[model samples]
Target: MMTGDAELSMFPADSRLFEDSFSAENTYRVSGQNITIHQYYCANLGVSASVWESALHLCQFFESLDLSGKRIIELGAGTGLVGIVAARLGAHVTITDLPLALAQIERNVACNTPLSGWPSGAPAVCPLSWGRDLHRFSSAWEFVLGADIVYTPETFPLLVDTLVHLCKDGAVVLLASPMRREHGAQDFYSRVLPEVFEVELVQRHPESNINIYKATLR
Candidate 1:
């Protein structure tokens, strides 16, 4: 059974989630670049089809960084917004999600193709189930990104393992998530994550109840 906060995190309080069927093309201005994302809201496709507020907050946070030429990868990149923004800011970004979620991410990536400052055109869309296929990815990334991915308690171990694998070379890990108490976000950040990485709360948006954390291999 999903907790109230978990359900709320999965489905935003906005009325749009109740629509019979809908898709939205929302535009965002990040790092002086305008990015338009196409999002589909369907119960069948699960939470990966919609854009989360944590993603927007993370994109805003990215504006403060110099991402030029940095090798970055985003895990559970729903709608690929954060990765797209990073690519626009000159980062070579790879966006990954579950296999079922890749099509939506690919469409969003394609919609924003030829992102300025991206070395090899659009960001690469890949399937990455945490704790699996760890060998396929190298530990050479400069940054690892995730937005609103730490809600479920059952996935904590897998997610931590993936983070350890990716940040083996001291790559910085940035995660943005809502403070969903019932969903175990606090425990994950305070207890589980600290066991593996040295974590720091870099930014917090009170109005949105979102916190951005920066972690590095200890």
Candidate 2:
């Protein structure tokens, strides 16, 4: 149940959510700046429905926060839309997903960002496989961002493991997802995430089915 404005914030100037296919380009406009992202709709290689509704929720969250100069890393970055926005907002951002998504993420980052838009230049793209690849990154981030990532049941444990290793002690972590629990994601995340970090539910707006959580290491 997204608000009208929230739904509009999900796409760019000329974007259509359900026309053609997910491979169609998506446009996003924020604070007078514009960005376009391309998404591959295939899920077999670990890519799923291109852009998600929770991403819109996260974008709104970005507008409300002061992320200036923060070291931010986004796990499960699909099209890198949120990370691109974070970089554009003056954070040193790194966007990661499975290895297959690296090239597309890179392309989106490039297409959406101008040379002058990113205060710290472009976002770093990394191929992350959760528990198996936690060592590739230094565990010293000021903030970690995730959107629509808490969906798969089998990946839950590894996702938590990666989150624990990425954030510094007491670092802020923000995660958002639609309360779709068909695969048992809601149950697992709500139960286990608090074990490693102190968690609080963030109320963004009244009508969103998307749930946002604010957590910090204990």
Candidate 3:
């Protein structure tokens, strides 16, 4: 129910689902199973509002890959969509966000729990913030996932550091982000990431202007 330039623009007003105050619920069918997510919008915390395009792309990326038995952790998980899908696909997943987003993530995780054929802890929910609280994890993770987490350039170092700390054993980090013309996020990812880890483009789509990158310690 929008009009004017919003309805005419090609960028998809769906991302704006996070920009205002509203509650959202959606069922995502992945790998023959459907996972439902609950999201609440807070004008003050826009990122937690709803699903983003990068998440859907990431879920598709996961569906095509082999993640069985992997100890996976998803950072910056908004509505826990990708992680929930991964869980349904049989990966041991822990979906995380900052403390403010935990309740929403926990709720979605509960909705998809005991992922059919998988064990009881198919998907767990947690609160994780970059740089300051890496100690909560006592072990290294095999796979790390992030969707649309590269917006702010100022936090690049902290985010990269967290990846480094989590994947000390050479685990791969999968990050999907839309190419932004402003904020220097693209530039930082190109320059800094290679200095610390080996980077590769897993997929790219000009239409959506999103790129999924797979990185590991060099």
Candidate 4:
């Protein structure tokens, strides 16, 4: 329950879920896992529809892979859903997003898995901003993940830089995007990423119109 104007204004009508509407309690089932998360807008902090779907699609993709003992990091983790799924699937996942999304991410992290429920290799949340310093994070991760994180053309370079910096040598980077034209994000992957990563479309969810790419360090 919140009363502040900031919090009240955060929940926009366009994104609101009514209690009685079908799927009002938004949730997605991760493929190959016996887990379904009750996803929702970070009511205290806005989220776009693309981000929500992308997160679910990415989580399902990860669940379908062999990630028994991998080190994973997720960038722009809006609600930390993908990272949470990764953790449940046995990867050591670190979730990072802009500071504005941190509080909701932390709350979601707590709700999904409390301290006592911190499994052997559960996920953890941290602050990471694209185009900014990442010195706070430890050495590179074996796999970097993101979903619908490419919003503006201006942030494209920074996202690429962050991905390159976090990807360990020979490690893989997985990202999902609902193809936005003119954003130049797809171009960055086509022209720029090849210099540092061998990229390929590993999976695509046509139903959701989301494209998932797997990039390995070159």
Compared with the true structure, all predictions reach lDDT values of 0.84, 0.75, 0.77, 0.67
Tens-digit lDDT string for candidate 4 (120-210)? 4557778776646566776557888888776566556667777777775556889888776666567766776778788998887778677
Encode model 2's per-residue lDDT on 68-179: one tens digit a residue: 8988999888889889888888889999986667888998988877766678768999987777776678887988999888877656777788888887655688998887
- The true-versus-predicted C-alpha distance at residue 198 of model 2, in Å, is 1.0
How high a TM-score does candidate 4 get? 0.77
Predictions ranked by TM-score, top down? 1, 3, 2, 4
Which stretches of model 1 miss by more than 4 angstroms?
1-19, 115-120
Best by lDDT: 1
| C-alpha lDDT of residue 191 in model 2 | 84
Tens digits of lDDT, candidate 1, 32-74: 7678888777654567777889998899888788898899999
Which regions of candidate 3 fall more than 4 Å away from where they truly are?
1-20, 114-117
My TM-score estimates for the predictions, one after another, are 0.88, 0.83, 0.86, 0.77
Q: Candidate 1 deviates by what RMSD? A: 4.7
The local lDDT score (0 to 100) that residue 65 gets in candidate 2 is: 86
Error of 1 at 169 (Å): 1.1
Clashing pairs in 2: 12-27, 12-28
C-alpha RMSD of each candidate structure in angstroms: 4.7, 8.6, 7.6, 6.2
TM-score computed on alpha carbons, candidate 1: 0.88
lDDT of 3 by residue, 136-159 (tens): 864467889998888777667768
Which pairs clash in model 1? Answer: none
